[model samples]
Target chain A: MTTVAPETVPAAPERAERQRGQPRWWLYGAAGVAAALGIWAILAQMLAGGGGAIQRLASPLAVGEQLASYATDGMVADLRSSLAIFVAGWLGGGILAALVGLLLGRVTLLGRMFLPIIEAIRPVSSIAWVPLSIVWFGFGFSSKVFLVGLAVFLVVIVYAVDGCTRIPGELVRTSTMLGMSPMQRFRNLILPGTLSEVLIGFRVGLMAGWGTVIVAELVAADAGLGAHLMAVQRSYDIAAVMATMLCFAIAGFLMTVVFTWVERRLLPWRLEEQR
Target chain B: MTSKEAEALGKTTRPRTGSRHPLQRIGLPLVGVVLLIATWEVTVWLNDLDSIVMPRPMEVLRALGDLVVSGEFWDDVVVSLTEFGSGYVIGVFAGVVVGVLMAEFSVFRATVHPVVEALRFIVPFAWIPLVILWFGTSLLGKTLLVAYATFFVMVVSAAKAMQQVDPTLTKVGRMLGMSRWRLAFAVQLRAAAPTIASSARAAAAIAWIAVVAAEYVGASAGLGVLIINASTSLQTDVVIAGMVVIGLVGAGVSAVIGWLSRSYLSYV
Candidate 1:
C-alpha cells in the first residue's frame, strides 16, 4: 500500500500486473457463499421436524424453491407496494428534513427555540413511532409512509442542519464580500456546500426508512413483503419466510448499490482520490 | 462511535452561541416547548378530535405518569432489558470472534467476509418472523432478532479495527519475539479495542431498535407490546406515553455509552 516517489509512478502498473499471481478474491467469495449454504443445510438437517411436514429451519435449497415459486407468485405486487411506500416515505421525509435543517442552521432564533426539542426527540428510535403513526394515520399505506418518513426525517435533519451551519465562516465571508446576489450566493456557495452532507443524510435516511417500513408493514399492512411474510410465518412455512427474507436482502442490497452509484456519479472527485 | 453518535453529541453550534446569556440559552428552548404544547392542544381543540384519534399533551403526560408507577410497565422494561442484553452480548461475542478470525486468517476473510457482507444488507427486523417461527412467541426469538441485528455492525467494526492496527507496532511486537496469539491478543486486539468498543454504541442503538421490532413480532411483554396493545385498544395517550418512555431509555443508553467510551476507553 505504500506509495513510491513520482519517478516510480510508471512502475505502479507493473506492480499491479504482478498481482495477478495472488489468490483470486471472487473464488474465495464464491467459497464463502457455498460455505454459508452448507452451514444452512446442516442447520436445517439438524433441526428438521419429526418426519412430518414441519421443519423449523429451512434449508437453502428449500428457500430457493420458494423463491422460484415467487417468480410466478405474489412477490411482484408485494415488492411494488413495499417499494412505493419506501420511496414516498424516504423522499418526502428527506425533502422536509432538508428544509427544516436549512432553517435551523440559518436562523439563530428558531434554532435556539427548537434545538433542544429536536435533541430530545432524536434518541427515540423510529420503530417506536410505528404504533403512534398507526394511531394517527390508521392501518394503511399512509401510516407506513408516515412512520418511514418520520424516521428518515429525523436521521436526515441532523445532516441538513449540520450541512448548513458547518459552511466555513471564511467561505461565507468571501461570498458576502463579493457582493453576490442572494440567488447567486445560493447557487454558487450553498448548493455545493450542502450537497455532500445532504446526500449523506439521504443515504442514512434510506436505511432508517427501509427498516421502519418493514416494521410498519409487519404491524398492520394489507399488502407488501412484510405482510406476505406475516402470512407465511403464521402458516409456519419456514421456506417461504426465508425466501421472503432473501427478497428483502436482495432489494436492500440493490438500493444500496443504486445509492453508491449515484454518489460516485455526483462525487467523481472522491473516485479520483483513490487513484 | 462513528459520525452518527458524534453528531448525536450535538456539538455543532452557531459560532457566537458560546458566550450567550445562560438565561436565554435555556429560556429560548423552553419557549419552543411551550409553543409545541400549545400547538398540540390547539390542534386537538380545532379538530375536535376523539381521544383515540389524537391525545392531548396533558393526557399523554398523565398516561406517562401512570406508566411510571405501574408494575406492568416495569415488567415490560425488565423483559426488554433482558432480551437486549443477552442478545447483544451473544451477537457481539460471535461477531468479534469471527472478525478476529478474518483478521488473522486469509482463508476466513476469503470465505466468510463476502457472505457476511451480503447478509448484512438484510434488515434484522426481516428475520423476526423467521425467528418467531423457530422459537415461538418466547424470549428466545426476541433475543435472536436482536442478536441478528447486532452481529453485522460489530463484525465489520471489529475487523476494520483489527486491520487498521499500526503495522509498525505489529513489527515491533515481532521484533520483541512475541508469539502469534500473544501478539494478536496483546497488541492487535488492544490497539483495536477503542474502535471496536466505540462501535458498540452504534450496535446498541441497532439492538434497541431490533428489540422493539422483535417484540412486535410476538412478545408477551415489552415497551413495544405496550404500544401495540394501546394502539389496538385505541388508547392513543398510552401509545404516545410508551413512545416517550422508549425514547427516554434510548437516549439514556446513548448517554451512558458516550460516557463509557470517553472515560474508560482510549483510542490507539
Candidate 2:
C-alpha cells in the first residue's frame, strides 16, 4: 500500500523522525482506552460521593446498562425514525446537489452569477434556519427533512462545484477537439473525474445531516433519538442522557464505517493514493 | 483548512471564470439579489400574508434598523462574542499543543488517539442538553461546548498537517544539529501553520453555530436567545433580523481568519 488510512497514514515517513526507538503504539492505544474509562469511573464516583447538584453524574457501567435497556420497542422506533430522516435527507440532498453543482460548474456564467448568493447564505447554517423552518412549516416531518436536506445541500454543493470546475483544462479541450457529444463528455469524462471528490463531499455531508438532525429534533419533535435525549435530560436522568449520546456515537461510527466501505469499493485508487 | 475546506471557504470569486467582463460578473449577481427581494415582496403582497407570519423584506430591514438602535442587541452581541473569543482561543491553543504532541511524540499518539477516536463520534452539539443541565445555560458551559467542538477540528487537522510536512525539511534540521524542540518549532510548525490557521477559522465558524445552539436551548442572552424569543413571540421580522446578524458575524469571523493567515503566515 502507498499509504495508510487518514489517521494511520502517519506511520510512514513520520516514523523516521522519531527521537528514539519506535513507540509500541498498539499497547499505548489499549492503555489509553483503559485509562480513559478508569478516569471516567473515578470521576463519577467522586461526584456521587461528594453529593450535591453535581452528584448525578453517571458511571460508565451504569451508562452501558442504560444503553442496553434501551433495546425496547420505543428505542427501536426512535432509531428507525432518526435513521429514516437522515437517509432520506442525505440521499435526496446529495443527489440534488450533485446535479446542481455539476450544472453550475459546467456553465460558467451560471456559477459566476449564483456564487455570490450562495456565499451570502452559506454562513447561515442549517441550525440558524430553525427559526425560518419553524415559521414556515412548524415542527413537522417536512421541516426537519428540509433542515437536514439544506445542510447536506449547502456542504455537498460547494465540494461538487469546486471539484468539477477543477477538472484538467487539457482533458476538456481534448474531449472537445474529438467532437464528443455533451452526453458522452459527461458520461465518460466529467462523471469519472468528479466521482472521488463527490464521494468526499458525501462523507462530509453525512456529518452535516447528522448534526442537523439533533438541532431539528431539539427544536421540536415527538420522537427521535434527539428528542429522547431531551426528555431524559429534563428529568435529570444523567445515565439515560449518556446512553443516548452513546447511541448517537455508535450510529455515527456505523455510518462512517458503511461510507468508508462504499468509498473504498467504488474508488480503490483513492484510498491507496490519498496524501 | 484542508485544501477541500479552503476551497469551500474562499470559493466566492472564481479566477477560472475571470475571462468575462468584470461588470457582468458583478451586475448579474446583484440582479439576482434584486430579483429575489422583488419576488419575496410580491409573494407576500399577493398572498396578503400578515407581517407576523411573513414579514416583507422592507419590514425585516426596518427591524434590523430598530435592532441596531436598541441596547439589548449590543448586549447580546457582547455576550456572544465573549463566549466565541474565549472558546476559540483556548480551544485552538490546547488543540495545537496536544495535536502536535500526538504527531511528534509517539507516546502521546498511542496513548491519546484511541481515546479521541472513542469519543469523536459523539456529536458535540448533543452535549447541549447535558451542558444546560450541568452548567445552567451560563457562559461556562457554552464556552466548554464551543471549545469541545473546536478542539476536535484543530487537533485532527494539526496532527495530520504536522505528520505530513515535507520530510526533507526535518532531515535538514536534524543535520544542522538542531534540538528536537528546535526542529519542531523552526521547521515543523512553520510548515503546518497554514492548515492549522485555516482549520482554526473553520473552527471559529463552528463555534458560532455551537454558541447559537447552546443559547437556543436555554440562555439568558445572545443572538440565539434573540432569535428563539422572537420566533416564539411570532416576531418574524426580529427573528429574520437576528439571522441576518448571525450570518454577517459568521462571515466576518471567516474574513478575520483569512486576513490573519495572510498577515502572520506570509512567511510560508
Candidate 3:
C-alpha cells in the first residue's frame, strides 16, 4: 500500500489552475494571426504587380472569393468521399495492427522472428505502393483505400508493439502474486495499460492515412479533394488550388482537434503525466 | 559478492524464459524473410498470375541487377540523394533558428504561432500543385517542397524542446556570470540537443518522402519518375526495383541518423 501511494498527483490540479488564469493569451494569439494575414495580403498584392497576375501565387482576396464559391459548389461531396476513404483505411489498418501487435508482444519468439521482416518493409514510403495498389485494385476507391491502409499499418504496428512491450514486469508479478489468472491479468491490466499508447498510435496513423489518401487520389481518381486539386492545377486556376488546399487544412485541423478531445476524455490519467 | 547473492541477482535480471542465443536472435529473422519470399514465389507460381500484375521475385532481382548496371539508374539515385541532402540541411538550419527565436521572444512566438499552426494542417502532398506552378519541375522546386515539409516538423519539435528547458538551468548560468548569448548557446542549446536531434531524424524521413512525392508529380528524373514510367509501360519488375531502391535508401538514411544520435547526442 505504501508503495502505491500517489506522491506527485496532487500537484497537477495547481498547475491546471495556473494555466486557466491565462486569458490574455487568446488576445495575443488573435493579434498575431491578424498581423500574419495582413502581411500575407500585402505580400500577395506586391507579388502580383499590376497587369498580369502571377499564375502561380494567387492573391488572398482571389482565393477567398474562390473559397466562398466552392462552399456552394460540390465541396461537401468531395469532403465526404475523402473522409470515407481516410476513415476506412485508418480503422482497417489500426485494428489489424493492434491485434497482430498484441500477439507478437505476448510471444517473445514470434517478435524476434518476424520483427526484422516488418522493419524492412516499414521504410517503404506509402507513395511507393501506389503503383502496386493501382495495379492490384485498379483506379478506384479500393486502390486509394489500400494505399492509405498500407501507409497507416506500419506506423500503428510500430507504436502498438512498443506499447505492448513496455508493460512493467513488476505489474505482472504483483498481479500473479494476487492470484490472478493469466487471462484475467491480461484483461484487467495489459489491455487497459495499452489503451493509451494504442490511441496515440491511432492518432498518428490517422494523419498518415489522410496524407496517403490525398497522394493516392492525385495519381488516378475521378473525385475527391485531391482530384479537384489536380483539375484546378491543369487549368492553371491558382485561386481554386489555394481554396482546395485551405479545405484540406481546415478538415485536417478539425479532425485533429476532435481526436485530441476524445483522447483526453478516454485517458484522464495521462493528463497528469503529460503535464 | 557471495555466490548466493550473485545467483539471486541473476534470477532477478534474466528473462523468465531464459536469454536467447545471439545466433537465434539474428538468424530467425532472416529465416522469416526467406520464408516470406518463398511463399510469394509459390503463390504466384500456383496462381499463374501475369508478370504485368505481379512480377516473380527472380524477375524483380534481375530488374534490380539491370538497374544497377545502367547509367540512368545512377543518375536518378544521385539526383534524389542531392535533393534529400540539400533540402534536409537547409531545413534543419532554418527550423532550428526560427524555433529558437520563437522560444526566446514572446512577440515572435505569438506572431508566428498562429500561421505555423494553420499551415501545419496542410499535408506536404497538398503543396504539390502550388510547388509545380511556382518552380515548374525544377530541382529547386523539389528541394523547396522537401524543405517546406521538413521545416514545419522540425520547427514545432525544436520550439517545444526549447520551451521545455528548465528555468533553473538558466538561473544557474546567470549566477555563474555567463552572458545571455553564452548561456543560450552553452546551456539551453546543450539541454535541448537530444530532442532537436530526434526531430531532425523525423525531418530527414519526411524530406525523403517529400522528395519522392515531388518527383512523382513532375520530375524529369528520379526513382519516383522511374516507378511512374515503368508502371505506365507495364514494366512491373522495374517498378518493384525502384521501390526496393527507395526503401533501401530510406533505411540507410535512418540508420545513419540513428548512429549519429547514439554517438553524439546520448547524454540526454
TM-score of each: 0.90, 0.94, 0.91
Q: Write the per-residue lDDT of candidate 2 for residues B102-178, one digit (tens) a residue.
A: 88887778789777766667767788888888788778888888888778777877887898798899999999999
RMSD (CA, Å), each prediction: 4.9, 2.9, 7.7
Q: DockQ, in order, for the candidates? A: 0.49, 0.55, 0.33
Residue range A96-211, candidate 2, lDDT tens digits:
88888888888876776676777788777567788888778778888888889988888788778877888898998899999999899989999888766778888777767898
Worst 10 residues of 3 chain B by lDDT: B1-10
Per-residue alpha-carbon lDDT of candidate 1 for residues B136-245, written as tens digits (9 for 90 to 100): 77887777777877777777777767877888989999999999999999999999888777777778777887888788768789988998898888888998999888
Worst 10 residues of 1 chain A by lDDT: A2-11
Using DockQ as the measure, which candidate wins?
2
Give the number of the best model, judged by lDDT: 2
Give me the runs in candidate 1 sitting further than 4 Å from their true place.
A1-23, A50-55, A272-275, B1-19, B266-268
Tens-place lDDT per residue, model 1, A1-275, is: 21211001111244335434565755876888987889879878987854332247788889999999986889999999999999999999999988888888777789888877887786677777776776677789899999888888877888887888788889888988999887898788877777778887887776667877778888885899999988898888889988998898788767867886787789877545545
Instruction: List clashing residue pairs in candidate 1.
Output: none
* Range of the 10 consecutive residues with the lowest summed lDDT in candidate 3 chain A: A1-10
